[model samples]
Target: MRTSFIKKKKNASTDVALQITSMADIFMILLVFLLKNYATSVTNIAPTAHLSLPEVNKSKGVIKETLKVEIANDLVMIDQKPALALHAFQFDPSEDGPGGVSPTVARVLNEQRKLRPEPNMDSSLLVMADQQTPYSTIKRVVASAASAGFVDLQLVVVQGE
Candidate 1:
């Protein structure tokens, strides 16, 4: 059986209108509700390959722009660029920072500070280290960055399970 709504008329066609006013209203309400409850501030930066951050429930703002330093077990990367490769715990003395610090990282930092002199950005350097990375290595990297004028450094970590 066919519905009469599909019938074609030579003169005025049958007036078959869909009553979507309520659906439109519902959709509008839903859009408004979702927009009203949307979070514009809190941002979550996901960890990349060869990097795993510790999960912790903490209220921290997202970094819009900053110099990133990633310290993995086998390599150290600055701003996603591999700065130095590590073999075991002992890094190449000529390639890394100074005493008890990352030499190559320190060199790279120094070069970056010399090349791009962003006084404000120099402070906000974020370090994303692996979970298995030792605390001492983290401290050394922090110290290296500090020596390179990066005082406001943040250690990024995962938020939850």
Candidate 2:
């Protein structure tokens, strides 16, 4: 008996490609969500030195229509306006017992608080100070605001880049 050899044939075909439309749709949804959550009225304060703020576990969101106090190296601003010039403070060691916040800061805060619709309501005051700023300076500013009847104080910090 004679045996014969046979050759096998291969199928020429390609697998189905994956569709990326679903992924694009998901990304679009995520973009919309992030855009909706973006803050519109953010108060930006440029500090003279990098400051690492003491953190708290609690989360405090922004309060609408609040006062802002910016403390720079040699000047202080209220609501982004120059309320007190550099020479406004008495740097003389003999005259001024200790460095103090400008009286105008307290007065302005008081006036703004009065103008607020809900004076009795709990309103927040945001304080932005440079990192190199001495603790005494921070305390003085906070004390002035407190004396002006600002109970809720929020120290502003950069959350992330």
Candidate 3:
């Protein structure tokens, strides 16, 4: 009788060896549900302290799929990295002894272009400028981007709160 009881216990333990297929099924269902509800078409790029975009009423939504250059009052940033510092809204590129286009900006733009497949300077650029930024300063940044071959520039602005 004892031997029969031991045999029954062993059989029960074997039957209880964790049912993993059910757990796997649950995970698969959850993954499918999440994928179906995921939002993939829109890309959102938020502004930072160094780049405070002006508020505009009739502008389109933000485009974050392309390369970005941010021009601040005292700094220029590309890809969120500080590419150069300005002295009173002026930067002398170390590459070209003082007084041409901001060399640092030009060089960084060229480098950024290399990441694209097109050999020509045809990368789309987004310029995020502050409200207090001067028009002349904005022109210099646009010119530098154009020289680097990025003609498709979309100015970044915020919606009125």
Candidate 4:
């Protein structure tokens, strides 16, 4: 036998409310984490004035922190200080020591080496040369750097698009 029962009354409020407090908390945490770890891995130093750096189609390897040797058409600077002057993209014969090494450049480099935390460690140098700089001038700078015990040399160039 089936029996009929009285129906229960329904609540007047039918809409459900969404609580976004937990979602807001998660969004804030993610924002702070991303901002804290943001980084830009690029060289901070700008190109010297009036210096046009060579452009390369493709560049390889990461840039390391090293002493800078900026070679322009008329001057050679070590760590932005004038080390020597270039006449016609060449050093004077009197300024050149044995094997085309520059005494001034070598002296400055040696002093920089001594100032380093570990003087005995292998030294690396960065060469930022103008596009108009001659090969001979670059060669002399390399020789001087070698005489000062800088073996690892890196050339700085602009990336071509």
Candidate 5:
């Protein structure tokens, strides 16, 4: 009996079939994580030094029911109420009268404090002024608040654009 030898044939093609389900799952997980983190990390913007601020030794943080004062040209709003209506003044260090901030801020703060005086009141005065508002105005507001027995003063500003 004679035995015949046979040759083994090699497979011609070799290509990988990609499974996209795992890749899609990973992308979805990353997207969800990023979205969740972004939702939790929201923050407000604050202004820079292009705007001037007064020098105060004890600048403190803000608390609830803060007395917000807004100083704009020809307008002075106290706690979102129109407190004073006067012409806007320039930043003049040599001015004899009250500087940038309205002179009545102190009195207003004092009155508010008197009306709602509680032990260890942490309420603060929040000053929001325009960028163009002069340093004198800021100084005046700060001075008024300080004079009104508001040791805690917070300067509100917009964050970087």
Candidate 6:
């Protein structure tokens, strides 16, 4: 009887082992997928020496997709690319088109508008101008942007404590 019981136990086949290697492979693939798709939410704001932004007590946070225009002492940049150059912080009258709009600025802004997801809905620009920049130059830039279908404008300034 004892020999029969041992044979029955041997035939039961109770030596099953869990397959962990496949599970581990699945977890590694998931980790890699997550890492590949991860995107940072932080926005970067860089300050340059050529532009001196005015100080304000309160200001709103900048949107990541907003078009940025920087006016320095000697140059005007769109999205950090030089769009126009100024002589002694002044623009030439010939640079202005009909209705006092800058043709260079208008062309660039139009190109940017087409790249937007909703161009009409995002008709806004963030302008950072030097403190010493003349108001006339700023106005011309604004006019050019407006002509390119960007009507909502926000001036970027240094946030004060």
* lDDT of each residue in 67-156, candidate 6, tens digit only: 888888888888778888888778877796988898988999899889888977888888878888888888889899999998887787
Better of 2 and 3 by lDDT: 3
User: Model 6: runs farther than 4 Å from truth?
Assistant: 1-43, 60-64
Off by over 4 Å in 4: 1-43
The digit string of per-residue lDDT tens for model 3 on 35-110 reads 7766553334555446567888877775756777887877888877788877656655453433435666888989
Local distance difference test, each candidate? 0.72, 0.64, 0.73, 0.84, 0.60, 0.81
Q: Compose the digit string of candidate 4's lDDT tens values, residues 28-87.
A: 999888777564434345555458889997788567877888998788888878888887
State every prediction's TM-score relative to the real structure. 0.62, 0.55, 0.63, 0.72, 0.50, 0.67
Q: Which pairs of residues collide in candidate 1? A: 95-104, 96-102, 96-103, 96-104, 97-102, 97-103, 97-104
Model 5 TM-score, all chains together: 0.50
Best by TM-score: 4
lDDT of 1: 0.72
Q: lDDT of model 2 at residue 68?
A: 75
Tell me the deviation in Å of residue 36 in model 4: 12
Global CA lDDT of candidate 5, please?
0.60
Which regions of candidate 5 are displaced past 4 Å?
Answer: 1-65, 90-103, 117-120
What shift in Å separates residue 29 of candidate 6 from its native position after superposition? 32
User: For residues 34-88, could you state the per-residue lDDT of candidate 5 as single tens digits?
Assistant: 9998776522222221234334454454434466677776566676566655456
Residue pairs with clashing backbones, model 5: 45-159, 46-158, 46-159, 47-158, 100-136, 100-137, 101-137
Clashing pairs in 4: none
Stretches of candidate 3 off by over 4 Å are: 1-44, 61-64, 92-100, 117-121
